[model samples]
Structures are given as C-alpha cells and as structure tokens.
Target: MHVLRKAILAAACTAGLAAATTPALAQTTLRAVMHSDLKILDPIWTTAYIVRNHGYMIYDTLLAQDEKGVVQPQMVEKYETAPDNKSYTFTLRDGLLWHDGQPVTSEDCIASIKRWAIKDSLGQKMMTFVDSIAAVDAKTFTIKLKEPTGLVLLGLSKPSSNVPFMMPKRVAETDPNKQIKDFTGSGPFVFARDEWKPGDKTVYVKFDKYKPRPEPPSGLAGGKVAKLDRVEWRAISDAQQALNALSKGEIDFVEQPSHDLLGTLKKDPNVDIVASPMLKAQYVFRPNTLHKPFDNPKIRQALWYAFNQEDFLMATVGDENYIQPCKALFICDTPLATTKGMDALLTSNAKKAQELLKDAGYDGTPVVLMHSTDLKALTNLAPVAKSLMEKAGFKVDMQSMDWQTLVARRAKKDPPDAGGWNAFLTAWVTADVMNPVSTAYVNAACDKASFGWPCDAQLEKLRDDFARETDPAKQKAIAEAVQLRVIEYTPEIPLGEYVQPAAMRKNVKGFVIAPVPVFWNMEITK
Candidate 1:
C-alpha cells in the first residue's frame, strides 16, 4: 500500500469469452453461507475479522489492490507525501456522490478520522495508534501520524483495516453518539438494509443507483463493481445443508467445507468448486523472553528442529505444501520482509533439540502449546512434531479453542499469566503484503497496560522507524530487525506461510481470491 491513494484507472480487457446458457446472475440474487460472520459491523471500531463483511458493502478505502496484490488508486485521483513523511496530502475527485445524494468531500473524511482515531463510539480499540486528521481544502486532506506509520498505506487499502474510513461528516456529526447509524458511502454499492444478529445471519442489498466506475481499467471486470443486486450471507451449522442448497441451486456458494466435499462438488455439474488457498500461513512462536523455558534462546531455537511443517502440509494437502515455513518474517514477495531468523525458526533436528533443552537445563520440562486452528492442514506433522519434541526431552501439552476465544486470550490479559500458555501455534494472513503490517495485527502489543505480555520498546521504535522510512534498504533493515526481535524473544511461534485459495464455480465469472473478498467485484456468468 502506498502513502498515496487509489487511482481508479478503469481496468480494460482483451475481449469476451464463450457464453454459457446460465441465467444473467447479476440481477439474480446470490446467496452465500460462511462458517461464521465477521463479528464487528463498523470496521473502524474493531479489528475483528468478521466486521469486514460490512466494510466490504458500505465503506470504500482510498486505495484498492489488484489480484497480484499491487496497490491501485480508488476514490482518490492523486496524492503526495511530505518529504519528512509525517504528513500525507490527498486530492479527491469532484462529484463523487454518497448514497443519500450528498457530495463526498475531504471534509467528510477529515471529520470521520477524528471519530475513528480516538472516539470510535462503539469503544472498539483498533485505532488507538492514530495521531490526528486535518483537512486543507474541500478536495484535499492530511493524515498526521503518531509516527510515519509504514503500514498506513496498506492498512488503508485493506478491506476493513483498523484505520479511519471516510463517512459523511454532516449527518454523522449531528448526533455523534446518539443514533450511531449512518449508511452513506461513495463506493460502488450503498447500504440497502441489514437484519443484525450475533452469531446468526445478515443480508445486504445493493444500491441500484450506484455509479459504475469509469472505463478502460474497467473496475467491474477488474472487480470494483457490485454486479449482483443483493447478497444473503447465512451462518449454517451443517456443511451438507449449505452444499445441498448450492447443488439444488438454492444458494450461489458456501465457504469452508470439509475436504470430503471437494470431490463431491467437483462431480456435481450443477455446483462448481471454489477452492482457494486461504492466504499466507505465518509461523508464530513465543520467544524465550516471555516465559521460563522458552525464555532460554536454546529451547526457543530447538522448536524449529521439532516441527515438520512440510510433512504437515503434505498430509493436509499433498503436493500443495503451499503452506511452507516462511524461512523468515519477511517473505520473498513482501517488500522488506525480515528474511533473517527463518532458518533458525524452521530447524527440525530432534537430537539437537534435546541437546538444546539439556544445555538450557529445561530437558523434559512440560510446555503448553495452545492452538486456535481447527484442523492441521498437516495432521501427520503433529505426530512428527510430537516425536521430535519428545526426542528432544520436552513435554508438550496441546489444547484447542475457537478463534474468538483464542483472540480474547491472546489480546486480553486474563488467565495464562503464569505462562499458562507456554507457547502457541498459528498462521498469519500476510496475503503477499509486507510482514510488518500484518504481523502487528497478529502479535504486537497494542496497549501494554492491557495486553498480557510486557511491551518491547524496541519493537515500538521499529514500528515508528518503518513508517517514516523512505529508503527501501533502510526500511528492509528495520523490518528485519523487527522480525529478529520477535524471533529471538518469541511471544508467538511462526511455523509456516500459507496462500489463500480463491476457488469458485467455473461459471462464477470475475471471481478472485484477494486478501479480503470484495462483493462488488464478482459476477456469475454462464
């Protein structure tokens, strides 16, 4: 993500493909069911993954990314960052209208930032790092930062990142905290309605009056327009029930079914299989600094020797060991991903692991391994890991929990203070973006007073340094330092990186598996 904004270059295509006999799906309603809902409704207030469903519908980021994860401009026509990097100037395009027919302006965003930065009325804590927001003119605005935040650009570009999303200042500011309901946006879709329920279902209707993004980098073909008139997302308990609906053509699609269904769907001509690599799987480990045994770097290093991630990926997905060890925090694709410490993190020497525990005087000591994952893409790897860790003379205890519970434990300071969790295994969704940005979301101590772990002042500084850094080499070095700091101190362990797969029915036209799924960009063609 760039410090600037999205340039809505109408995406162009070569020509048309063969046509099918299917009905025109745009006007037809599309029903989709997911395993769960993204929890928060207002993206600015919470970093909860589920909130994105709402964000994808009403809010529009200044920049939009392409399939290759390249940052492209959106609502913004152009912009520039100050030489010092503390301030960013953005120029908005004229005549963009919100759903209520109000002119979208810089003033709207300026005011919205003020609310999201410190007083996101819902009490959601995602924007605690924002410094300030100010407008220079009707068409221009500036975002001031606590530090030149490196992830600001990418954060802004995410489907629903923690940063401030623009809203019409007029209506929202009127009662500020009273109603807290404003459905106005300048994006491709407008808010139609929602029947909200926690852990239930929600429906969103499209704004027919929505303006089509201009030509040539045709936004729709490139996935910027909301092709369907409406989308109904349900929370169904049974995969068969959802897939049954899909096969009977009762629903358009369903997400995250058991592996057994993959074959069943492929054989059924009515339903097309949508298989997507979930995204980059990050290897997170607790550094030796957080607890006793892990506090010893030797024991920490011994972990790499204990894990057989490749074996795990093979069992989970043969030949699709697409989930491989990251080698380091900064992957090859991300700009300035810390490439150091990966080799140490991915080691699998059972004898050496035992020697490390012995040298550190922690041999045979039991350590807790908390997992938020439901199924190991590589189940076999667990036994291999257990054997290696046992060979190394360490007692491993494992437990599993739902994602929300896991988030509460990791982000909130509750039990597990007495090293209740010696260490944990999980993956990060870097999505081919820089590690620093996503890494923070996964492990950074947002508010030290509240988080269970002691804050690393060095990481805080690195976060600051990476933000303002302009020189690529300097930024890379800083990023590497951050990765090394995390690796050496291990609060969370990193095991492997994964690629999110975007599988759709063969008839699902313009389907893409972006880091965040965008409804406006999809179409069903036959």
Candidate 2:
C-alpha cells in the first residue's frame, strides 16, 4: 500500500497527471458516483450529506463560504451592516432568475430565511437576535435585529445542512418541518426532475441563464461556472464497482472509494485520488435519549467507557496516516478542542462498564444499533459497537438498512421493537462540528434539539454563551465548559477523526476543494 501510494504521489507531482485540455464540447456530460443515494430532496429537512450536495446543485445561497471560511456574496450583489450593527441590508444581484423563469425577489429571500431559520442550528441562533425580516423592495431586504448578533453572516453562509438556500416565496413558504416538493432555484445547475430516479440516478443540467461572477471560483463562493453541460450523480452502492468504472473511464469521478481498495486504485494511472487537508471528519455514536437504556446517563456512560476510539478508527479507516483517535467533541486542531474528560474513552474498560451497568440496574434491554450497509464509511460501526457493548454486559440488536433508511428512521420516536433505533454511528466533517454553535450533535434542547434530543439546560446555556461571546479567550473558556458538560452528559460519543479522499478520472479537471463536494467550475477533457 505504501509503495502504491508513493507511485501515486510521484505521478501527482508531475504534469503528466493533468488532463489534456481540449475545446469545450457541445453536449458534455460528467457521470460520477456520489457518497450515497439521494433519498431525500429537501436539504432543510435533513442533515444528510447527499441532500446537501443535491441542494448545492439546484439552489444558490445568498452568501457563500470561501475556502478560508470567509463569507462572500453569492446571490446577493452586496450587503451593508447598519452603523449600530442592529440591522443588515442586502440587495439581490441582477440576472438571478428562478428555474421557473420568475425573477428572484427579496420577498422570496425573506420567506426562505424565515423557513431556514427554524430548521438550521445556526439559523435558529440567529433568529433569537432578529427582530423582523422585511422586504424593502423587489431586490432589497433588511433584517432588523432586536439585539446585535455576531453570527449573521456565518449562519447565512454556512456551507452545510439547512444552508440558507434561496427559493421562490411560494416554495419557501412551506412549513420548516414539512419537506417542499417544489425544486425551483436560481443556481448554476437545473435539477433534471424527470431524469431523477432516487436510488438509481439523479441528473442535473447546467443553467445557461446563470450569470457567474467575473472573478474565478473560490470554494462555495465567487463565480460558480458550470463548464459541463450535464452532470449525472449515479448511485453506485458498491465502492469497487464504482472504482472499476472510474478506472475504465466509464465514470468521471467517485465521491468515496472503499478504504481497503485505495492501494489498488493508487496503482491505476487513469485515476487521481484527491484530498484537501481542510477536509477532516469525525466518527460519532449518537444515542437516542428519548428511549431506554440510553435515557439513563449512567447506562450511556457505560457504553462510552466500554468502547475504544482507536479500535473504531482502525476498523473504519485502516490507514493510520488518514485516521486519528480524537477525544475532543469540538474536533482537534481547533481552538476549542481539548481532551477534558476523554480519559474514560481512551481505553476500553469492559470490567468498569459492566460494574456501572449492573449498578444502573441493567435489564438487558436490546440496544437497537442502526447498521448502514450501503455507506462504506459507516457499515463497520454497528458490528464494532455491538461487540464492544456486549462485552460490557449489554444486550445488542443490530438493525440492517441503507443510509437513507437510517436517515428517515432515526427521526422516529418509537421504541426499538417499533422500528426505532437506540443508537447509530455516523460521521461529520470537522468544519461542521468544530464549534458549539456549528455542531448539531451537541445540541441539548430536549424536544427542540437535534436527532438525539439529549436536553440539558446547563449545557445549552453554555453553548448559548459561547455563541454570544465575542472575545476569543472567553469563547475558548466557554467551549471548554461545554466540552466538560458533554463529557458528563454523553449526548453523543466522539469516536475519532479521519480524512476521506475522493477519486476522479484524470480527465475531470478543476474540481473545487471545498468542505462540500461541488461539481461547478469542473470540466471534462476529451
């Protein structure tokens, strides 16, 4: 594997890896396999990565995050903050037209912001300070704040789940809890609704009407030039098959190649394995606090001590260079990252866990672990978790399903026997979980909280303080406080961190290295 990686490294450094530039083709189409199937279409409804990717294809945001994580105008021509910092005014850019041939308006943006505010974690935080969101004119809108908020741009320009994606007012008026069927947006690509076949394939065509900014594309900001005429996101569940397709030039890219097969893929001269240093993800074990035995914090802590972060990290990502045993819930390499109460999770203490479980009156309740078989990155987690938990004297019931099934099923408040889950292992990009305000898993707002819904008033208050804190030193102190509380209240287990690299055909050029996989500014060379 090392030898193959070295060969790949040498080739990558050479210009030979660059595709031969050719004149643009009239009907260019780039076919690729995404990380998962596009089961859900509404980005605001779920935190699923596939839906977020789909949202980027069809919807444009008011502001976008650059590679440096700075907010820049996308749909907006420019924005101005009031002298008192109590109001924010924005004007929509010209040539912004919805897919349905209607002019984009501030009314549409106002409704979209309101609907998004209810769903997104950051948006919800922003809403607390917002007094009223009103349309000033056809293209102008203002958000008057009851009090000043520091995260206005950050919330609006967040590059992840529940992104402030603009839509027509009618479509944006849909309830935040309800999913919208309408898919009209004024983005660089048009969703080929007729061609979409859910688990089979999803198609997108470049919007010729899209007028990109004059400056070059930068992350999710700047100009979004859709060089390809069409983009097809095929659902290839088998990583080897998808890699084989990429090797044979049948597919232009593969979003995630099987970790075990990386060595063989590295040997192929036709493929280029690309990874951004900024692209870091942490594996997590989320316990449903609404049900037993996870509802008991002692029972939850038993599983925490029983499992080892290194064991899970090794099993998920075999390469040690790509994986790290991260104990910090805020993520490593970030300011707030600290191993405050991680000593319990550093080593697997099955004996200690068993003792705790017995003291907590363990009745051998079956822990319904949701096993996502289709997603290669998450498939091994259930088996690993089951083995560890059973060793700790806990009963395990592993449920098998695709990632999409898990996404929908996790939302259920039913008991284990009634198609509900006790806990499920998933991963989040480090950028998404680095801060208290950004991480959805750490939210402990009870019924109003994220999926796990582990409500703790103290923890929520600490997070709220972190959001309002302008001083970096104060924010770090608040973050540490939050982490200590997170350790005490095991809302979710932070397994570890690893980097997943995407593979693409040599002909697929100009791929953007953003936190989210974007197809814009990329072209296929003949």
Q: Write one digit per residue (lDDT tens) for candidate 2, span 448-523.
A: 6778889899988887787778899999889888888887788988899999999998888999999889999999
In candidate 2, the residue pairs with backbone N, CA or C atoms under 3 Å apart (3 or more residues apart, or in different chains) clash, namely none
How much is the lDDT of residue 122 in candidate 1? 16
How accurate locally is residue 319 in candidate 2, as Cα lDDT from 0 to 100? Answer: 88
| Model 2 steric clash total | 0
Report, for every candidate in turn, its global Cα lDDT versus the true structure. 0.54, 0.84
TM-score of 1: 0.72
Clashes of each: 62, 0
